[model samples]
Target: MKVILVFLLALGINLVFAYLLALGFFYVAEYFFGVCLTVKEVFFLWVFLLVVAPLIKLKFRSEE
Candidate 1:
């Protein structure tokens, strides 16, 4: 349960980080890429968080 909680926390932090990064990208995008994100596209960050969450679990598993 603790590991699961850690995964959830990590996932949440990853999401917040992704959102802030994307928000910053918006400035560069508006100037150069001229691209803007929609709600669906924003969820792309989940793929990263999912992969990361499991990698963390694996890392600690060996320590135990």
Candidate 2:
């Protein structure tokens, strides 16, 4: 039960991080490149990053 709670908390934090990242990316792209990314597209990118972030972290961690 404690493990599950910790997992939930981590997942929530990861999701918020992914969302902020996607929003920032979207804004920068729109400003510099005039690329108009829809919310749906940003959401997709967020989900993709959320899934990939842990793998990336693990890869860097293993090198250290």
Candidate 3:
């Protein structure tokens, strides 16, 4: 039960981070290049970052 709670908490945090990142990316692209990402595109980007970000963090941590 404790493990499940922790997992859920981590998942929630990751989701929020992904969402904020997607929004930032969308705004930056729109402002700088006038490129607008569709909802589907943003969702896919968020999912990709959610999966990859943690692995990247782990890699950097291990190298330290």
Of the two candidates 1 and 2, the one with more favorable TM-score, higher being better, is 2
Model 3: runs farther than 4 Å from truth?
56-64
lDDT by residue (tens digit), candidate 3, 2-31: 999999998888788777877889999999
Which pairs clash in the backbone of model 1?
none
Worst 10 residues of 2 by lDDT: 51-60
Clash totals, every prediction: 0, 0, 0
RMSD of each: 6.1, 1.8, 1.8
User: Which of candidates 1 and 3 is the stronger one according to TM-score?
Assistant: 3
> Cα lDDT of all candidates, in order?
0.65, 0.86, 0.86
**Residue pairs with backbone atoms closer than 3 Å in model 2 (clashes):** none
Off by over 4 Å in 1: 31-64
lDDT of 1 by residue, 1-64 (tens): 9999998987787666556665665567667887776656645644554456556567888899
C-alpha TM-scores of all predictions: 0.50, 0.78, 0.81
1 or 2, greater by lDDT: 2
Give the per-residue lDDT digits (tens) of candidate 2, residues 1-64.
Answer: 9999999998998788677778888999899999999978988999998987677668888999
